[model samples]
Target: MTGQFQKSSMYMEHNPGIVENGDFRKNLDDDGRPKRTGTWMTASAHIITAVIGSGVLSLAWAIAQLGWVAGPAVLMAFSFITYFTSTLLADCYRSPDPVHGKRNYTYMDVVRANLGGRKVQLCGLAQYGNLIGVTIGYTITASISMVAVKRSNCFHKHGHHVKCRTSNNPFMIIFACIQILLSQIPNFHKLSWLSIIAAVMSFAYSSIGLGLSVAKVIAGPHARTTLTGGTVGIDVSASDKVWKTFQAIGDIAFAYAYSTVLVEIQDTLKSPPAENKAMKRATSIGIATTTVFYVLCGCVGYAAFGNDAPGNFLTGFGFYEPFWLVDLANICIAIHLIGAYQVFCQPIFGFVESQCAKRWPESKFINSEHAVNLPFHGAYCFNSFRLVWRTAYVVMTAILAMLFPFFNDFLGLLGAASFWPLTVYFPIEMYIARTKMPRFSFTWTWMKILSWACLVISLVSAAAAIQGLATDVKKYKPFQTEQ
Candidate 1:
């Protein structure tokens, strides 16, 4: 948020044109429900919901894989990278001053406008993958969080380790059913309340997690000595150090991977304080907010559990002690993921529906700015549309959740494959192309160098994640590690 990143906003003065003439008109959807209502508050809320979902659960586990040093260091590093790239994305929301001014509404639109060629098609693929991955990831997380709470409650109530009979797949599917109903909301802006509530929930769970970790670690006899001792918990005996390192990188990347929907988020802003400025402020606030919670969650949770930390921090708090807090935290997590699932899915739904509209405009979709009415092509068109695609996405992900409930591994794969291209590579390349800073020039050179580094990191991370999956397939055995 310093140096060249700080561009003077057009509304430096108290210009009524900028404030009064805000997104009131520019933001209306085809159905006239007023699409853009994002202020700094709502925008930051969306960002928090997008960036902080379930990823915080793995911060401790990731720290264990990377150890104290590399883990927190990499976390902070991703924070800076996310902020920078988000700003680059914010800057790209609108065209150059002279050209007809309009926001890029979609991620692919930005790429198509700036990079051109097959880049647009490529971006579309990456974006959809990232979006779908996140939706599935959230569902998986919600199920785990809910089940953990149930098990912990059973244990605490009976003063025994009660093996809760609640199944994981059913819970995931249940949440997906909820998502199918909630995700019917047409525009991203409409969910501002949902995102805000989710953000508050995120902070609640994360803070509770941090509180429980501190209490646990401090309650132990050798509390002060348990702090970061350079090589204290460094697992040199780990079977796959090289792969684990990259897996840790992918985990960090996933924790910070919210770039894919940034444009759609930018579109939600009502364009008063200027979308770029508002976006930058919102990004900074959101990242800063999440970073505080992330650092605390990662640091304290790792300190409390060390090498044995569960992938989900709340799950590690145990069934006996702090049972109430743990239950509350997990409940918050489950509720929060519901909203996050919807937030991420809006972009995917839009992409699919818009494409369908272009292909079959006569299908009675978006006939008005406010709503869409698909004809019952065979006496049940709406039901057919709902079942065929949206429901399938939830079911497909729920089935995957049944198979691979591991949060960190899922994060590794998603971050490496999807965020690699969609989040890291595209933003850097787009910025370089948009700025036209002469390929070999000093500024451009460094940007290119960073882009290459990010690319290599992404590829290595993906390979490590794939390797981990190959090894785990036989051993995982469907939700067996709850112990």
Candidate 2:
């Protein structure tokens, strides 16, 4: 190929649907992109996955430590902050001539553009580390979900129950490896229908779980507890200052998680008008739906568990009349988690592809067209990539999951730490520094306050979460049940 043809071919291979002029035009325009219609629902599902994660399972414990009133109150506060930050970041994407495409800047791009070149690279490194951590966490969760389901089935089939083990079951290990490798395929967008099904399953599972817990609590008679000797329990009484602060941090960071996808969602919209409206509509719908669900889960779970509530709400069932119902419920939860993993893992693949393309020009696998032919060129080439990447994902996830089996708590902390900088602080800072704004613009004021607030809260929550994790880590012994 001539030098010009080679360059053009490389561009075509990497850019896919985009033309040389930067507009999206290609033979297969819709092949590998998120759909625009029903995007509101998709957005809602994204918000739920971002917010819910493994956190939902352990929220009751976190709330109990803080107190019942404190827990839901914090959740609502976090919800509001998240909404505010998401809106501000979305507006940043609307600015003309953004660093990346107008609506496709990743978290790293936002930081690089605002914080100068060195900080951009630093932030990218931090984000890359974070993404690795996140990928591992999600993978571990997926594996655990599978294990939980299988164990439940075993109990159903045989009267004898076995303790959960995470050994080298060669068959399962191979199956998981295959699933991870297949998930890395470039054409996962072909499985977009899975996203829809995942979304529905998540909402349904949340609804049923919350409803059953509430009904069980209400139908059962209240039991009284006697005060223990000598030891005074930590204050259950609510403190507004602590409650509001924690709540604000949680809500803001929760919304901040969606920052990664905000620009992608905007790009997927049909036109500028549609994009703008969709941003506003999606933000509104996402916030409203999540707020309702969070409140319901928090309130219903607290009521059901009362003072005797287990640290994690999801695990503590008084006892269901039919044993099969509990098994079915566990299956629903496992399926919901599969959906959650799909949402979380998609971005990891995107990140890996972007990095591979940037770093390995000669590999040609970095180029889109070249990637399709990778499997055939050399057996070792394709297998090597698969083994290296998938192993990296699995190993990372196992380490993190083992280290912090307090999955839900770690998620909350992770949300607070990363979401604020990536979504709230960086975006608004970029908008102000990169684009001209009026001295007294309400938008500027709103974004500034939101960003600063998120920063402070994220710092505090991250510290607390890390401290909590360390404590739990010291107590955890392998082969013992996870707390």
Candidate 3:
């Protein structure tokens, strides 16, 4: 015990910020940083903020493609898979021993610890690329919500037949501006309040959508719904139905694609109860909550609009009667996405900034932090490179969103690209490696089988999404997608 104390004292000499408590664990974390205050509740807020994003708004359209039985079944299945895999990932937040191993600060760090070399690079590419795609998708979705408010008002004032065409470019620009300001919030550690607000907004908009759908279902004639899916000849051709079904699967996958950032969220947790234990509980709660909302929104919306359900029920003008309520819901969606955009993109921002600082340590532009005083708020730490890079990143995504505003196609494609590799394959592989599960054993075989099945689903979803994008590209002109 004396020797251990001596070693800990020596370590503290170097890491001054960390001090050992009576339990021998540091008051501050293992890293020489401030003590983490995150509880299971904050972790749940982060997960909900990340998971219940713009993707949830598309679930109605996804269910429409799969019909009554298959739709709800698929939602429940994805929820279970996400929760299970997330628990496995939670165990991996620490190293060899889940409860007491060394900390991994980021998702890439976790991958590097378990599966090194080429796999690490692949994981980084998939994880960061998916984040970028998510930001772009959020930009498009937020703009759509903004446009929906204007269009809804226009429809209410004029007749339904009048063309209330509004260009999404302006709204996209406005969303980008808001993100530019929020992007300066530094890192994930400081985003708890924003995440909480976003979580509430997610629930609000989802509830509004659910209430509207239930009202529609009660009010009168609903669109035609089928048992299996879209009718072959009547609703769509056989080939189209196949593609739509696959795309719907992709949409569902995207809605559940928060695993990419799971480790980052876990890293925020204060440990005495252990980060893994807290994260597992948070994952269960977050996934269960979102799943309930998803089922209610998707199934009820499908019942209201059936096979013709809009890609985004709120923004798609499905509930046009209560114009004020529709406006409020869209406003909530836009606000929710504002925070969600920062949640996903901040990781990428941190990654780039860290790399730049490391590679160019002496470059004042990258390394220097300035204290800029605001009127009411306290002095803020500002970095020139951060401002320039993050603004450019937001601008680039905004431009891309304007160029390709095919909402459903983009969501499906992003989901298909990310679902297997980040959400399933990496977590499973890392878990297997960490556990050192014997090869070819029953457990090992089944895990591999699950991974392979998800891969197949991802591939088909990607193909379908590509087909849809191609079809939409032929119909709509870039930068001129008016609704």
Q: What TM-score, over all chains together, does every model reach?
A: 0.84, 0.75, 0.92
- Shift of residue 17 alpha carbon in model 2, Å: 12
**Regions of candidate 3 where Cα sits further than 4 Å from its true position:** 1-27, 407-411
In candidate 1, what are the lDDT values of residues 369-471, reduced to their tens digit?
2222435522211223433567677778777766767654655676687766776678788777777778689988887787777888888988998888777
Off by over 4 Å in 1: 1-35, 98-100, 160-162, 223-238, 317-319, 365-389, 403-411, 478-483
lDDT of 2 by residue, 1-483 (tens): 111212223334465544534334432223233334445555555556555654455454344444545566667776776676666566655445432244443555545445577767655654555555555556555555455555545545663344434332332354355456546543333334555565566576567667766777778764222222011234333443344345434533453366655554444444434455556677878677767766676556656655455543433433333345554555565555555554555556566655676677556434523222333433111323434665576555655665555564566566666766676666666667766777558978877777787678777777656665667678766655521
lDDT of 3 by residue, 401-469 (tens): 877778647766767888898889988998888878999999999999999999999999899989988
For TM-score, the strongest prediction is: 3
Query: Which parts of model 2 are misplaced by more than 4 Å?
Result: 1-38, 66-69, 94-105, 111-116, 146-175, 185-191, 223-256, 316-321, 368-396, 399-413, 438-447, 481-483
Instruction: Please say which candidate is ahead in lDDT: 2 or 3.
Output: 3
In order, candidate lDDTs are 0.73, 0.54, 0.84
True lDDT of residue 302, candidate 3: 88
Clashing pairs in 1: 30-369, 31-369, 31-370, 376-381
